[model samples]
Target: MARPLKDPTGAELARLNLNVQARFKAAAKAKAQTHGMTLTDYLEGLIAADISDLQAATGIQEALIPKSA
Candidate 1:
């Protein structure tokens, strides 16, 4: 069995090969840095926030902390 040891956050990370415009990526990275978060964390937070509502309806337990109602 392969040990999933690379991710220190305890979540098994998956690779996502996203292709975005260079300008968009630069903007996102700048925003992430402005907020004192890594680019990955900022993107993950955005995805989590977007799906939090659906998560309640479907009973999907996401690792990210959902917004308070």
Candidate 2:
């Protein structure tokens, strides 16, 4: 038997407005549905991925900078 999902506790919420076209919004919802994820999950994953990529790039850039004695 599959286990039931646990409810999240003490999670904070934030709200933002997306000025995207209706078609883009629909497409994103459809993509998320196809992957069995809610729209929120899909967006969160995208944001997390972008943060990771930016961090990696920053690390590389820092490494290339010369340190002054």
Candidate 3:
């Protein structure tokens, strides 16, 4: 099993690193409030949308590609 992060090291600093854009964060917060959902749930839904889009794109690309002999 994975161990927990130890303090007094760089773990706290690492945890502070955020890659999300400011606009996305604000939009997520607003949508979550509108739907009465926690921010985590809103983000999960957003991620699900992204995954679905990726899958659709992949399927379209596959359809366009010729099969190997």
List clash counts for every candidate, in order: 0, 0, 0
Error of model 1, residue 28, in angstroms: 0.2
Q: Write the per-residue lDDT of candidate 3 for residues 1-69, one digit (tens) a residue.
A: 112233223335233345799998898788676755556545544554667673354332222222221
Q: Where is model 3 more than 4 Å wrong at Cα?
A: 1-18, 47-69
Top candidate when judged by TM-score against the true structure? 1
- Tell me the tens digit of each residue's lDDT in model 1 across 1-69: 112234434546688789999999999998776766566666766775688673453222333332331
Clashes of 3: 0
What is the descending lDDT order?
1, 2, 3
lDDT leader: 1
Clashing pairs in 1: none
Give the TM-score ranking, best first.
1, 2, 3
In model 2, how large is the Cα lDDT of residue 16? 60
Residue 29 lDDT in candidate 2: 88
Each candidate's lDDT (Cα)?
0.58, 0.51, 0.47
Q: What does candidate 2's lDDT look like per residue over 1-69, in tens digits?
A: 111132133335456668889998899988766656556556654664567663354332232222220
